[model samples]
Target: MIKKNIYFVPLFLAIFSFVVIAVALQLDTSPEMIVGDSMQARSFPIFLMILNLILVAVLILQFYKNQPNPIPLEKFPTWGSMILFLVFYVLTVFTDMFIGIFVVMFLMCVLWGEKRIWVALLTASITPALIFMLFDLVLKIRFPRGILTNIYYG
Candidate 1:
């Protein structure tokens, strides 16, 4: 039955990616808006969808070969990590993205059994700083205004 197949998730993802690719192709982009040799609005999303499909194919092949799941279904921590990602999203939407990153990183480290509080705190602190430096300074990209970003940019 379909419920028993290990490959179902990847197969379903692949099919969904195909649907997304089809939809992405329908996105309207003005010819005048595209600079010479520049990618269209839909290009990056379609590319990512194609990449997802390729990875799904690889996952399907791995499943067909009977490779054991790396994280067993019975592992509560693994499921908790998945839920934590949802929490991260909600926090990012309601609060600042950096705050979400800091909270999630610290919580995830502790959830995964990190014993050292200092190490977890360092991870929570350093990651957002590094991300800010990379995107704001190195890449010259500006993040949307938020609690910390407002203070920093102001």
Candidate 2:
């Protein structure tokens, strides 16, 4: 039913979060004296891990609570949408982050039945731009600028 499929998304997220946490745990998080003892590199990962665990716990609890009330399957999107999402996600690894996210978000909105073109465009553009600004400007993290970026600068 729709309820069951709905749960799959959260379950997948929980699993993915756990995987991230596992990878984070393996990172050398030891504090550098230059950065100070208060700024242990591991702190952020540990914080993320804790947050993920909390989310997973909440998801599991919700899954149990909703298991008895499954909705009809007719409400669900076509299975191909999920497959497409996965495909795009993998492809994004090889593409520019911003472009990949914009394309994917637009396609996903259309695939999941967003009817308004303007809304879809806004969602696609705004979301990725916000993420880029947050990571690049605020967090000082770098993102791969794909071929288009090089061409633009040239």
Candidate 3:
């Protein structure tokens, strides 16, 4: 019997990666200028895309160099987590990144055998605030608030 073509899996991934990088590179951030920073608004997206491309290349190299067997992938949240995050990502285009991050973190924690409901919920609730403090205050990065901006304006 002929061996199945597993090489296409990595090839498809590389192609998808290229498409993502192309989309990110084509994004228009010209509406506003990024101030108070050494890098421009486009810097982050461009940097991320290039990094992703580099990682794809590394993955290809490793696949060829090692020629590992195609073991069955992990079950449970491995693929589901990826799809969930992708859906949340699409939702973030309309919603805020902060809320999305909070929801995902909470969901992951709960999925990871978090026994105590109160403890799990509390950790999720406070996670966003702590992250805000660390990123917004300590790291000096601002996050979008979506509809919550008006409520928190006071």
lDDT of 1 by residue, 1-154 (tens): 2234566688789889989989998998868645557888888999999899889888877776775555445677788888889988988888788888898899899999999999999999998899899999999999877788889999
Q: Rank the candidates by TM-score, best first.
A: 1, 3, 2
Worst 10 residues of 2 by lDDT: 145-154
Give the Å shift of residue 124 in candidate 3.
Answer: 1.5
Write model 2 residue lDDT over 39-125, tens digit each, in one string.
666568768877977887887687777674545565445675677677676766776656767787887888888999899999999
Query: What is the per-residue lDDT of model 3 for residues 1-154, given as tens digits with 9 covering 90 to 100?
Result: 3224556666776677677767876776553344554655557766776787788788767777777677777887787678769866965667766667767777777777788878877887798878777876789875666654435443
Predicted structure 1, TM vs. truth: 0.56
Stronger candidate by TM-score (1 vs 3): 1
Each model's lDDT: 0.85, 0.72, 0.70
- Give the TM-score comparing model 3 with the true structure, all chains together: 0.54
- What candidate 1 gets wrong by more than 4 Å, as runs, is 1-74
